[model samples]
Target: MPETVGDYLLQRLRDWGVEEVFSYPGDGINGILAAFEKAGNEPRFVQSRHEEMSAFQAVGFAKFTGRVGVCMATSGPGAVHLLNGLYDAKLDHVPVVAIVGQTARSAMGGHYQQEIDLQPLFKDVASEYLVEVNVAEQLPNALDRAFRTAEARRSPTAVIIPADLQEEEYTPPQHAFKHVPSSPPSVARSVVVPPDDEVGRAAEVLNSGEKVAVLVGQGARNAADEVRQLADITGAGVAKALLGKDVLPDDLPYVTGSIGLLGTRPSYELMRDCDTLLIVGSNFPYTQFMPEFGQARAVQIDIDGSLIGMRYPTEVNLVGEAKGTLRALLPLLQRKQDRSWRETIEKNVSDWWDTMEQQAMLEAKPVNPMRVVHELSPRIPEDAIVTADSGSSTNWYARNLRMRGRMRGSLSGTLATMGPAVPYAIGAKFAHPDRPVIALVGDGAMQMNGLAELITIARYRKLWSDPRLVVCVFHNNDLNQVTWELRAMGGSPKFEESQSIPDISYADIARSLGLEAIAVDTPDALGDAWDRVLAADRPAVLDVRCDPEVPPIPPHATFEQMKSTAESVLKGDPNAWHLMLQGAKTKVQEFIPNRR
Candidate 1:
């Protein structure tokens, strides 16, 4: 039997060392489905309920493993469904290769069923690389370039294969005019180090400042040790961009927690007071949360030269890998003689954690959302991989959850999309089958798609060495984040019609899918619930009823924000009294001294 393009595609993916392809079956790619059976699923086809989930799982896998994630879908709607997740990958700077099916060539221009002009559709998302394979000869080069470009640019790339062409006999490109042949599959490695002159200038700026501050982003993951050394020499307080939350552990005395709207007081203070700033591997966009322009002399280190000085007005821009550039800079830096700045940062960090505890323990209608994460912080396994969905619950995950040991975590950092937490955990499981994965999701996100992905977790649990995948849902029965945004940002009362969501028992739903389940409505039960869920033999869901009125107040709330919230209350917000009371109780903790 002649090898079909579908068969060749799978063979090439295997040659590139792809272990799995997250996808769903569709007739547009009937050739690939047949090839999967003929090839004995060499590169496993891990199916998801939706193509979006498959793309998200690939993103999760890529993010955790530092490899290119691949996801496939059939033509039209199936291809359309992959956009959200692929956009998530693009925005967050993840490497992903999407193999999507297109309608048969003969039927493409006739207004055929499921025929949409795919080139324009994917032009933006896969802007790094997008090619349609018209002949078998184009398959290898097109696919290989997609992988190479995705890795080189750290962005999403795509290869479209027409349904009929996939079934045609495969043939290698001829050694003739107009033919392009690709080399064997392997990622080329290169080390980028900024010039010695640039590194020296950055060091000079660092040495001249009285209070130095370091901001680490996800790009700084590889340079954790270097970042620590830099911080130690300069006596700088390190603050993490949310995506870089795990870059440096919260346990570090000089490490302030997450920075931005969902940030901590210590992190806000670190930016506000520092005179010299060093940013590594993070392109955190919220410049307002950073040190005021011109107040601090800044230096940025990033592999991408384009993003180097875009965020802040940096005096020195180092275009190199964070680890290598920081390594060069460290040799030229002199240890700070003053210990006072270091002491102040440590004190601030300590007080912030105490305040987090106090706020987490405060009384609420049922469970304090902050306490849900606070309880899990100490109890979480040192090696656990945690994922959080976007919503009000993200505040707790960002501020309360402390990173320690070999733990890793992420969300849709740049996209800020919902429903990635559960799928991301699923991806994390595949990336490291031995590690336990936990997802902190809000009710709205769970309803959006996290609930459906539970079945995906249950199906794949046995494949993992450790079967403890816990989906902890904050069941507040509200679109809490947007509701608060309405009041805080828009000066408008929460319209119950838009803000309220269905109150469903997520635990019951999880049990129906043959997974362990637990429900906790009281603060006293949160710790025990987390313990049982973490210790479960299989995937589990912890559905805790959280307080909807608990405001995710910014660490540095401005007067305008306060005035807007007051206007919302006066305009008849449904939970005005509870919202104000909870806001007051939570904020008061920041000022209270920890007696313990």
Candidate 2:
């Protein structure tokens, strides 16, 4: 039905509802690229600077749309480069389809250039589905399976096309392996409801304990109303995993912000003292942040049955979709009459926010990092999509940025990879140009993968109807998060110099690429810079010179951490004094206990 296998593949992609395909061109993929040019451009081809960025962009597309984001690369090196981002999709349970070109069939087993066994190379990452097309006839079924498996399993899938096969004419078989649909296949995500017995048992465990804490993850994002109802009925304090940042508004009374090192003080205290833990859709890896294995009677609910009780010992485990499972459990749950537990956690949450506000206002030589996020949060549009790179910027985003109303956003969740923010923002903008998209990245990550994507942004910005994407680069000139973790992990402050990055002007680099760029070094100018960037007509970058010395202090501190900070200061570290002032000033107030 098509001139070539390549054309057929592109047609299948369009039929599968893929509007854009992120890719990096190479000689091995020449045929597919040529076919894309000939396809009349309905499914637009986006050329990314790096194969990895293309994959990350695909990941971002999947994250924003909840559909199979498609990406393509050449054989050997280009295909290999997609592994990291593909793993990000797999580990985070996002749907993605990666098409990789291979050496011509005649060149196979002869060790030709750019020829590697891609099946084994891609097997682990695209664990759900992977196949190589040896002949033109195999293309349709393989492509169909790729999309279906990616959707059903919610993981990355791969289809490898040999260079020769891609150029050959493809004729549909009268007796086809599978029915090639005339229209787009509608993959329905059916509601998975756990059995009545499992639901009843979980409800019982939750009702038996007085102090309940509800921990949620990305799975519960769509069921915020149900989550709030559960928390209300059970007198539970809701603590979100980093991926579930938008599950509940920060202003919610019983919400404890986030959990773990990047979490809020109220979250730590609530987890430490809770009598029962009702975990919904989160396999929170940090066992230390949760109550002792058996200390709290735990009830865990998740769509994937294998993940239940993987993090904590559970008294009851319900295997089902979060929204349906939660809806089923709410009616069976006994509403806790005691408001004291809920009030205590809410009071702590309020105090933590107050402390954060004070820290945000503290004036310093270089602008305080928290101050930048503080200024930006209020200006974010209600429907904006925000992505944060993995580093100190994530710390500020996790602790400072507030997601309210219908606003949605995400990061490199399970992979926690850097260099995703910029590309993720680009993909999100492409997915929904009507909504504002922002990327919060640190200097280190910007140097790694942020700059190349600007070229991609510049290329496609005009194509977007409301291309108001913003890249907020935190120019701290160091891998600040790693430095802080080194100090917090009982290491000395003297080693920080080795990790220091050179002073780089991201705004200058952005301006060179034809993006409207501005650099703000002073605390006073940060707000105005953000306003200008938001109000700009095209894609822009706002580079803020953030303080490298300030550490992202965890909500709860250990004596070892305190000693580490003191030891660093005693050793004459230049930024140690500011760290001490920032950390100890409020700690005294917290430990002193207000004398009424």
Candidate 3:
């Protein structure tokens, strides 16, 4: 059926239903590249600008499609470049498989060109499964195991093939001693449900309390309806983990958006006031954002037993699929008749939105960063997918953008790394070519690698059915997030050499590449600029010059943080006066009465 090991490898990947393999070319994968040409590109090779971008594209595809994403790279340095994106998948619990080339078996002991010990190098990142195929017979089993393990464990896995072995004549593992043959490529599916007794225990804890709060994470994505039903019955307010921002629509009356530093004020108040807590499919690590110890009776539901009872002291831990487990527990949970708690939550949520709008409209030197997302929120299409990078802008994305009508949003959540947003948008475009995709990135992240990814988007623009893919760059020439962190956490002033970055025209670069580009410097230009960019016939870039002095103050700003920030400003921070003015103006919105 196949002439070489490389041909068989591509065939097997097709059998596994892989549609695209994000990759970068090199001589290390020459055999596989040849096989791709022979196979007529059955599993299309989507080339990225760099090996790291390829890995990020795979991560993004897997995240959006809910399927195992595959990536390929050459040996030595190419393989080494994939580590950051692979670690991003690992930390965020996304399923991805990396196929990498290695030096020939003959070059194993000898330090030939592009030869390095790959197994030990990848051992930590691909800890779920890592294998190097030394023989033709080992190819099928190793590749199959990598795909299976990546899906089953929801982690990145690796299969390393020596350069010489890939060109060898294909051979199947025979029914002989010491030979292992893999079954056909298919994953068996099953729904895990916790025992009846555990469900009953969880229900009892939830039904006993009057003031209940529900916290959800990305793991609860499949259990959205169940989560909503449970919240409705319990008169509970639901708060989403940053990773679970799309799990529940923000329009719901009792849905307090996002919990943590870059979270909403309503979410902070919800956790502080609730006497009972129900956690579903979220392993949010911040204990400070959660209810105080010994204050709330808690019940947690998760598919993995190991993750349960680790974040909070739960009265009951039910280990099962989130949707199924919640389905089991819902029947036993008695609906709380009192509506006062729900009313209070709804009121707090309503006021928070008004405060957000007021803050977004505040005057700034050039543009208020919040207004960029604020304008886009209502204008964004119903079925659009949004990606945000790790920066001060993530605060706006988390608190400003409202999820409704099938909108999906994600960021580097646990890893919180820079430079994935634009690549993620490219991957999202591949996943659903019919849907419009948007990426919000700060200047720091945009400079890091996003500028290069625009070329990747430009090259692949014709493949998508919908041509609208927008990369909105927050053109604040500063590493804004870390700068604020230094002030708030380390009590240090902004070190200009380290914190300030050069301002480059991202719009000019996009236009040179023949993509529609818009540069917005004034606050008034943002809404119309969003309109023009979203209506473009091709991939576009919206570069908005924003005020760096604007602070991303946490909802529940600690007294110590305030003191530290004051200290940093007093210590001769360059933007000291402007920062103080912006911080005070933004923080005052919370105390202002809702005009509505």
lDDT of 3 by residue, 164-204 (tens): 88898999999999899999999977899988998998888
Q: Provide TM-scores for the models.
A: 0.99, 0.96, 0.99
Clash pairs for candidate 1: none
Candidate 2 — what's its lDDT? 0.86
Q: What is the C-alpha lDDT of each candidate?
A: 0.94, 0.86, 0.94
Q: Which residue runs of candidate 2 sit more than 4 Å off their true CA positions?
A: 176-184, 494-497, 568-574, 586-596
Which lDDT tens digits does candidate 2 get at residues 1-596? 44987888888888888899999898878888878889986689899999999999999999998888999999999999999999999999999999999999999989899899998999899889999988776677788888989998889999999888888887764566653433246686699998999899998898899999999999898788899999999899999999989888887878888899898889999999999998888978998899977789998989888888899888888999999999999999998888999999988887777777777777765888888989988888888899989998898899888777777779998899889999999889888988889899998999999988899999999988887899999897888787777677754674656777888788888899888899998999988988999889989999999877766878877889878867766776667777777666545544544333
lDDT, candidate 2, residue 15?
82
- The Cα error of candidate 1 at residue 425, in Å, is 0.9
lDDT (C-alpha) at residue 8 in model 1: 97
Model 3: lowest-lDDT 10 consecutive positions:
1-10
Write the number of the candidate with greater lDDT, choosing between 2 and 3. Answer: 3
Mind sharing the TM-score for model 1? 0.99
